[model samples]
Target chain A: MMNKPFENAIDAHGPTVLRVCRAVLGMTPDADDAWSETFLAALRAWPDLPDDTNVEAWLVRVAQRKTVDVIRARSRQPVPVDELPTSIAGTDGIPHEADPDLWSAVASLPERQRLAVAYHYVGGLPHKETAALIGGTTEAVRRAAADGITRLRTTYGASAAQEGTR
Target chain B: MMDTNNTPEFDLASALTVGADEMDSLRSELARRAADDNLLDVTYRTIDTPLGQLLLAATERGLVRVAYEREEFDRVLDTIAQRVSARILRTPARLDDVARELDEYFTGRRTTFDLALDHSLSSGFRAEVQRSLPSIAYGHTASYGEIAALVGRPRAVRAVGTACATNPLPIVVPCHRVVRSDGSYGGYVGGVDAKTKLLTMEGAA
Candidate 1:
């Protein structure tokens, strides 16, 4: 066997792992910790994965499960969508590297919507894949993505339009 | 129609590129601080030897940072400064002593590091792995499994590998002193060639 299960899991869903961490933890150090923990868990369990399974969905499911576990264990106060920190001051005295507006918009999303957006857009998964991961039908995943994007557009639409005018 | 100038100043694409560049700068900054000779809150020093420039940073509590051939030493310096809540400056004298000791080892004049290591940043198994690495001795390499065994967990070889991957203090902690039992040089965050060179220099080949 080519270890396709392990390789596919990492290759196909690695970015999703980063996206979930980014969404839930909002660029905090805890996000990195969560990401590492998720991968470590995956590495430990990868050998048992069925060859015909959906690796991306499986990884997302694992990541989601881990994130929830971490949240429950830590008893973190739920950060209101508007209150999450979006821009980290660059560690080297440079300007912030991430697009602050996009990040802020992403950070302001409800937790489920945020996860759906990350899975669909950032993870490059189709609506079906996203639905499978989050335990919803394809239509529900589509609605979540649409709702999330609409909120981002509403929040940033004026700026986007003003730029268009100029 | 969209105006290019009024477009959001930052976005995901820009952030990823900028983050990568920033990380590079940070690595260089750390290296520069390590080479400076002024006494400051953090101990800074550089070692020049056959491998390349090596930066050693320490706090009163313990060794906190090390960088090798780093292009972004400043960022590393800034991170250390922020973490230790101390001003960072150059203190080559402190580092020169370390360099001299390393030089002796490279020339086969010394077999062990006599320097006191400050590892307050690491704890539990991570610290245990680092502590166990030096016991591998010079000119001998141990597998990750073997090191984990020494740490009292016979099955934690992979975790031991992770510990090596995350070793912030590489040379001093001697993560390069570890290898795979299959005789393959496993992953080194500093790059595999660097790992190979360190092993070859140590005569482990």
Candidate 2:
């Protein structure tokens, strides 16, 4: 079993994991932090990963855990002010410049629904794998994702559609 | 972007899309951090030369592999991951010195490469042949028979040629300095044309 260069793994799945992290965390900096931490952890364990592993699913699982760590740390610490704005300059959802309505809608989602939607829909993992990451039966995760999408339609979809037309 | 099922809403995934530039910056930061945290096992980068883009890969020990573009860089990387560790990245910091030295060598500002070389890819008779190649000097040429004799295997001239062909590190290891006994360029790992170009640049051809 030939192992692929970890760079290939990053190139293939970096965007997917970043999207998953951003949706789950709802803040650019924390999401970036989670993204970096997830890949770093993956790199550390990359050699030991079985060659038969689904790298995207594995990375999403890692990102899921790393994002939880960031969330926990966020609650324990004072909110950090942006110190190096230029470094993270091109990021979306940069607070004032972000779509407040969309951000609020996502923030308003129940944690389970948000995670299920992110892991399954955003991360492109199957509901079974998403359920494995977030802990529930696959059927329950499918329902949660469906419910989350419905909630977003009412809360965020209207404004986004109106903005698109205007 | 509305869902295609006659749903009157934006696509959820597109709604959460991260910009391509944003993802690039994030990946760049991770590459740097992976180096800092010492998780980058095989760092690689490419530099353009007269021979075209040359791929350089390094372990923490030193420069591990140098390959020409014709070698198919992706395939070379896969081979490195299999032979070395799979914990590899395209971080260039580790190979900065190697690339700089190569640049200097190509421009005729440097004669000898002052880079640490990892010889993990070669062993036995092949290792002996490669180990003696640098001693052939900058503008000097040696025949396969001469290299065989130098390595104490005068009867192993063909083996010397094989070593040069399979050399993991090429110009840096000075394998091109080994020529045919008839004073002609033999087969080279970077193709015969690259070998001729290097020899002409060194004023040996």
Candidate 3:
């Protein structure tokens, strides 16, 4: 099998993986880490991958694994408020309207819902492939994506309308 | 909500947008990681000259291939990737010195190439032909018949012509210095116009 050069794989799938990561990981340093790690790992294992493989789907799978690792690693750490004085940033009863951002809205979702929405909405994967990546049936992922989008429209989508395409 | 046929209601899809800056940084990081892990076996970039853009490639050994713009650089790179190694990158810094030297050559500031070369593309009689080219002098021309005899195969002038035709390092190896016995500018790997250009620059035209 004639292997396509790995650089072509990067060009084709890098942005899609980045979008999926930003959705699931919320545009933080963690998102950048997930993007870099996915490509790095792909380069190392690239020669062995089947030539006819769906490269974007392969990269998204790696990004999903890396994103979950970052989240798990972050969750294991103590909350920042636990270490700081209570008087600092508002950690408790934070106002409903303070940070009405898409990132926070996405962050508020359960992990599976966030990933399902990200894979389908941003990565533009079909519900079947998104379900396969997330270890759920297509019907479950479909409902999760709809639920996630509905919540975003109610919360962040209002700001999007007010702000108009920033 | 820009609802149209097969469109979703919420415009939150744009929120997941990734910028070109992010992609650039990611690509550079991938190049760096590939180099550090010893996976990037080939690096290539293109240089612009009075003739046109020239594609330059290098392996860990030295400069490997230099192609004219007319050669369809994408196909050249693909062939190199298949023949040499699939670990290819279009990183310009890897060819910075070579490009600088080429700039000097075209501008008439330098004549000799102070760089390493990979002659894997030519071997046996052909490699001997390439190795024989430098002695033709910087501003002198030699006939293919002359080169054929120099490589000790006096009857192999056609082989000498083939060697010049397939020279992987054209300018550096000075393949343009070899011409027809009648002193006409001969076919160049970069085409006849490029040969005339190089020879004219060298004071041989």
The full ranking of all candidates by TM-score, starting with the best, is 2, 3, 1
In order, the first chain's TM-score in every candidate is 0.69, 0.76, 0.72
lDDT of each: 0.65, 0.83, 0.77
Over the stretch A1-166, how does candidate 3's per-residue lDDT look in tens digits? 4355666776677777876877777656677789988887887777678778878877888898998898788879887412211111222333322233666677778767787888887777888888887787998998888777777767775777688863
> Fnat of each prediction?
0.11, 0.68, 0.36
The candidates, ranked best first by DockQ, are 2, 3, 1
The full ranking of all candidates by lDDT, starting with the best, is 2, 3, 1
lDDT per residue (tens digit) for residues B1-205 in model 1: 3332133542332232235553334233433443342223466666776667777787656567778665356665655644553344344445665677778877878888777677765678988888889888888899988998898999999989988987878877789989999999989967898889878887887
Interface root-mean-square deviation of model 3 in angstroms is 6.5
Per-residue lDDT value at A148 in model 3: 76
lDDT of 1 at A50: 59
Comparing to the true complex, what docking class would candidate 2 get?
acceptable
Interface RMSD of each: 15.2, 3.7, 6.5
